[model samples]
Target: MKIKSYFQFTNEQRRGVLSLLLLIVIIQLSYFYWSSSKSTSPSNSNKSWLAMQSVIDSLKISQSSSEGKIYPFNPNFITDYKGYQLGMSLTEINKLFEFRKQNKYVNSALEFQQVTGVSDSLLLAISPYFKFPDWVNQPKKAFSSFDKNTYENKKSIIRKDINEATQDDLIKIYGIGPALSERILKQKDVLGGFVTMEQMESIWGLSPEVIENLNKYFQVTTIPTVNKIDINNLSVKELAKFPYFNYTIAKEIVTYRSMNNGIHSIEDLTKIKGMPNEKIKIIALYLEF
Candidate 1:
């Protein structure tokens, strides 16, 4: 019997194997052509990415512009930081500070301009939102809700010591209500007591009209004794806390005191390097020597 060899292939099987090999070679050639056509050249992709980045940058700019919108605020209370943010020049800011250092308030837009000397364009930009105290622009209707006891309690109205008066007592006066009464009491605490009714003019929201009412109804009969700071004894830090004394002036006062043995009078303080000459008279009210 003739044995079949295990390694030998029949004609049909050999043809099938050859056909399969031909198909694989044809597939590989097509794949090469397809890959060549679709290779990654990223010019268009890069352009799209750059265009997206530009849009994102524009959005950031727009967001920043929106954030710059100014709101209504009191111009009198602008601090150094606020002035800088509002684009005020150093000279203009200094002018405002000098005005405020005298304990005067900016009552109107025209007054603010005169005090700060801001440019006309800048003033137009910011002045629209410059809100002063309520009673300044629109004086409130007089307190019509006065109880019969308000007049009946005769002695209380004659001379209610401003420092001793409670909020209830303060509201009895016309043009004074809850808010104004609290402000008066709070300022009284900070100042120890009102020396002059003029001091009430410095309160944050009190208008001239309201101050007049307060003066009409109440008197600072008992000037609360304060521990007056002796300029010769106070350090620069202590002296600078007073409204009239700034850091530079206070430091100069201390230095001048040390140099000349001690400051003898207000004139000596005014002679200090940075001290305002006119400020000495009012500053003397808070200082002993």
Candidate 2:
């Protein structure tokens, strides 16, 4: 009888099992419905994200455009940030830096392009905004017209001796004026008179062209009488008074003279370390052993 009972199902137990199965089915159905309704579709989600991205992109474009507004500026003075805003490359900016380092400048838009090697289209874009100094835009003064006959007569004029040239004569050279003429005469007076044409180089303001003209017009036909200084016997202080010998060279000479019993010639002076070998010939003109 107990074995038979083990196989038998009570009505209450069967009903309980059926009720539990029904409850599980209801819960599963509710979960499926809730999941389908609560979650969004893939298409809708992508659409929403794309719309937000477009708004973000538009805002960025507007901000960049507003901030990048250009004003009138000198192209010569572009800083790194300013250059970036002007659409300049790193290479181009560095080229400008190298030009400025040499103490040179770009005076015109075309010159700026040549120095920086910017593109023509870019130059055209930026050139309208470039504001250079007033002097740069002004037309250069034209040379005055000379009468052909007068010009021919002037060219035929004979060159004169420079040694005897007066200040009025000196000013007739292309570059010389009142001030330069005065300086030349003063230097000549200091030297007791010009000896060799090479001595004209010491004149402070005479350009090579002016010197050439002076040489063309003048010759040291008569060597000036210079009172030669006794280099061996003069005190260091007195020796320093010579135009070519500064106090430092004078002291060095005195020190070497003391060590070697006295400097005898140009060779001895050359061996004194600080004596200028190249200028020895000129220095010898005013010095005596």
Candidate 3:
């Protein structure tokens, strides 16, 4: 009986120890699941804190580069963007200026690439602010009746010869700005005179628009003959040949004709603002309109 009781006590003790071990394992598993669930909950603030840190890092980089200004980024960062390149060259930059003058704002870097098959680095440098003005994208405004007729009247009076165009003849070309007109005159002197319309392109400041506009007015004819006795077309050298006409009077007459177009009739001679009537009549007999 004593041996059987001892064996039963040993069996009970083993069962009790096994039950306690199972309970401890169950509690450990439950605690682990609860901790995992808390970590994965959407209400966890750590994720937001990590995102904020990333944004702060990006802002720090931007501020350091820009000296704290928030202006748009410079185009030099094209290298950082995948598949983009600093593909333009110095020669391409010169071509962009030429293209811009001809097309105004119609051309962009993409269009330039299409036209020249090369990119422009200077244009890329300025591309961040590149934009066409509203007027360029919109249809052109029509000229008023007075403006149209005034241009027509002026066109009828102006005469041009590509071989012998004076500064005044160049000014008459539409779209030839004052600066460009002066450039043409300077080029004419430098080249010893223009032999062809293409020569105008050699001028450093001559825009393509000026060349196009002036081309319409160009004539490649023999130089016109000027009679020494005709005051209308006579140069200072020819006028000085007259016995009584001094260099001053010759220059004055040429200046007057330039301002008012050539004196239309002998009676118009007296209309020169400063010429005395007696002197006009003397010159009138020798002058032809």
Candidate 4:
């Protein structure tokens, strides 16, 4: 009877318990509905994002194809990086470099092929872009009669002392322009004058072909006298003022000089730690013991 009393509830209490059970069932149904909705929303979002990504990839492909189109460029000026982009091997590039070292140039695409020994397919592909100087492409004028003395006189008149060459003179060279001519003059001013033809290499943007032309027409007939540096006596700061040396190298040189009592010659300077062996000869030109 006591157990039966525990199982039984008052009418109001029974009503309250039924209401609580209904509230819990409603909450559970709402939770399940929202969970299923959230799951479906992500799947739809993923499908939309995938479609957008495919469109973006297609746009990138088209853009890359347009950008990858090669433009016409001078084949003679091709650097290793440029050659690599054009599918040239290291051997072909070296052959071009070797030919250029001899102060020779390939005036035509056919000549370029002969010198570099590039495959015919590569030659055909790149020849269209080979932009040689105007003089190289211009037809040679033929004279009906040849005069030996007149030809010699004209050749003599054509060549000039490089030290006295003005900007006007420099611009007359096929490859050199007003800007390059001005730069050459400016470098000449800074160094007081060029000591050697090799000094032309220091000028920025001077190509091998341009230098060859420069050599053909101009020569250092009179080398300018430079104020020589007293290498053994100068302080690190003073030594650093020399064009070939920087502060670190200057300091090392001074330290070496101190340790050895004094540096005697270019040979002594070369023995110093961190000294550039090849540059010592050039540096020797401006230094006294």
Error of 2 at 106 (Å): 16
What tens-digit string does per-residue lDDT give for candidate 1 at 1-289?
2355765789998999999999999999999998886675556888799779989999999999989788899998898888988989999999988998987888888889899999889888899988865457655576667787877775465766777889998887766778788887876765566676667765667766677878877787866775467888988898888765679888898888899999988778767897766545645676787
Taking all chains together, each candidate's TM-score versus the true structure is 0.52, 0.46, 0.28, 0.53
Question: How does candidate 1 score on lDDT?
Answer: 0.78
RMSD to the true structure for each prediction, in A, is 10.5, 18.2, 23.5, 7.1
For model 3, the superposed segments whose C-alpha errors exceed 4 Å read: 1-125, 128-157, 162-172, 201-209, 218-289
Q: Model 2 reaches what TM-score against the true structure?
A: 0.46
Report the candidate with higher TM-score, 2 versus 4: 4
- Kindly give the stretch of ten consecutive residues in candidate 1 with the minimal lDDT sum: 276-285
Candidate 1 residue pairs that clash: none
**What does the lDDT read for residue 286 in candidate 2?**
75
Tens-place lDDT digits, model 4, residues 188-275 = 7755677777777767657777798798888888778766788888999998876677899999988988899988987898888877
Model 2 agreement with the true structure over 1-289: per-residue lDDT tens digits: 9999986889998999899999999999999998887665446777899789989999999998888577999888899888988899999999999998986668799999999999999999899999865435645556667889878876786766566889998877666777788888887776667777787777655656678878767777776687688888899899888767789999998899899998788888788767878878877777788
Q: lDDT of each model, Cα atoms only?
A: 0.78, 0.81, 0.59, 0.81
lDDT for 188 in candidate 4 is 75
Supply the global lDDT for candidate 3: 0.59
Determine which window of 10 residues in candidate 2 has minimal summed lDDT. Answer: 133-142
